[model samples]
Target: MPVWPFKRSKADIDAKRLLEAVTQTSRQPALFGEGRIPDTLEGRFELMALNASLALIRLREAQGVESLAQAFTDKLFRLWDAGLREDGVGDLVVPKRMRKLAASFYGRLSAYGEALTSPEALATVIARNVFAAEAHAFAPALAAYAARTAETQAGGELDALFTSEGWPAYQG
Candidate 1:
């Protein structure tokens, strides 16, 4: 008997929702509008990190639901790993890539987590990571977007997420 997609486990359903939300958050046009965020690999990675940090932080705060968050993060990393392989990263260097990616994720997560607290902090972190201190041109817009997104994510419910089957409408 073939398994029906709608009959998936709660874990599977939640993972799908989380992935969709993350991708949608990353693609929010306000992010790239007027070049606030680059439309390149580095820019994409930074945007994903920002969204993941928000999701992970919220999940951690929800009592008894942290494991689900870990599962979601694991799935995202797995997708990244597969992408690396598809892009011609050798098997031998895959482990190294994983390590590098993990480090980058954690570092950005930490920076972004702190950055979300205030516009000043957000600007500093954004300048360091996204612009490499070259400029703070987009930091203000990016900070506003993060603040808005963080507010939206704050009201999301972990349990309800399993049944929420669509991509999020990101507001910048």
Candidate 2:
């Protein structure tokens, strides 16, 4: 069989599917509103980072499919980059913006990981990142939701990441 230059690898396809699931979950309206995540661009980005971080955390612990995780992350960033372009962000400035976005994502990932150890810490982190405030009344609810998601993903099969049903429903 001849090599097909344009064919996507299995990992790439799986990653795309997983990314789609993450994106759809992040965009659920229930996640945004008064006492919930803000519906602005920054708020959307924060939610995406949170959902993606949860999936990546589970992926890191799985025995195999490490490449799938990497592929998922690569596709995610590409999607963000495309969105930036669509918004008329100049090519000359996309790199700087992406770098800042990446930094924000990684910082959230670290804070979330550490915060997961305690409910109070998790709420604090959620208030800080998701709500962008010192203390939001609904931050604790969001924290509980995140904790539930992490637990669900931890017990789910790797294939679950590719489907919406794999993630816990948002109760916010």
Candidate 3:
């Protein structure tokens, strides 16, 4: 059988769907405002990173889904690359920016993964990363939301986790 250039692998398709779900959840209007996540680009990226990290954490835990998790991460970075180019980032600087973004994302993933076991730590992480402050009034609520989301994903079916409506509703 000949390979079709346009044909995507199953992992790719699943990853795309998962990424879409994550993006949709992160972009929810209720997640942003004066008392919630900020409405700035940094805030948006932070929210996206947070959601993606949660998905990745679940994927990593699921049996025989390592490839899917890797694909999801690859597709996410690719989207970020395209977005950067679309935003007028020159080719010369794209790599540098991507590196920075990757470092930030990985750092968050580590911090969040470690902090997830503790509510206070999670709240502190959210306040520092999402709100860019030492302690934000909404950090506890956001942390609670993250905890609830993590629990939902942990108990959800893998197939359902990749769907657009897979994530729990954000009441923030």
Each prediction's Cα RMSD? 3.4, 1.9, 2.0
> How well does candidate 3 match the true structure in TM-score terms?
0.93
Model 3 residue 145 lDDT score:
89
lDDT of 3 by residue, 1-172 (tens): 7677578879889999999999988888998988887798778899999999999888878898888999999999998999889889999999999999999999999999999999999999999988778999999988998998888888878887777545887776
lDDT of 1 by residue, 15-130 (tens): 76787777776777767745578887778878887777767877776787655787788888997888789878999999898899899899988888877889888878877887
Pairs with backbone N, CA or C atoms under 3 Å apart (clashes), candidate 3: none
Q: What clash pairs does model 1 have?
A: none
Error of 2 at 93 (Å): 0.9
Residue 46 CA error for candidate 3 (Å)?
0.4
Error of 3 at 116 (Å): 1.0
After superposition, the stretches of candidate 1 with alpha carbons farther than 4 Å from their true spots are 2-9, 159-172
For model 1, state the Cα shift of residue 46 in Å.
Answer: 0.9
| Model 2 CA RMSD to the hidden true structure, in angstroms | 1.9
Top lDDT: which candidate number?
A: 3
How high is the CA lDDT of each candidate model?
Answer: 0.74, 0.88, 0.89
Q: Candidate 3: list runs displaced more than 4 Å.
A: 1-6
Decoy 1 TM-score against native: 0.83
Candidate 1 or 3, higher TM-score?
3
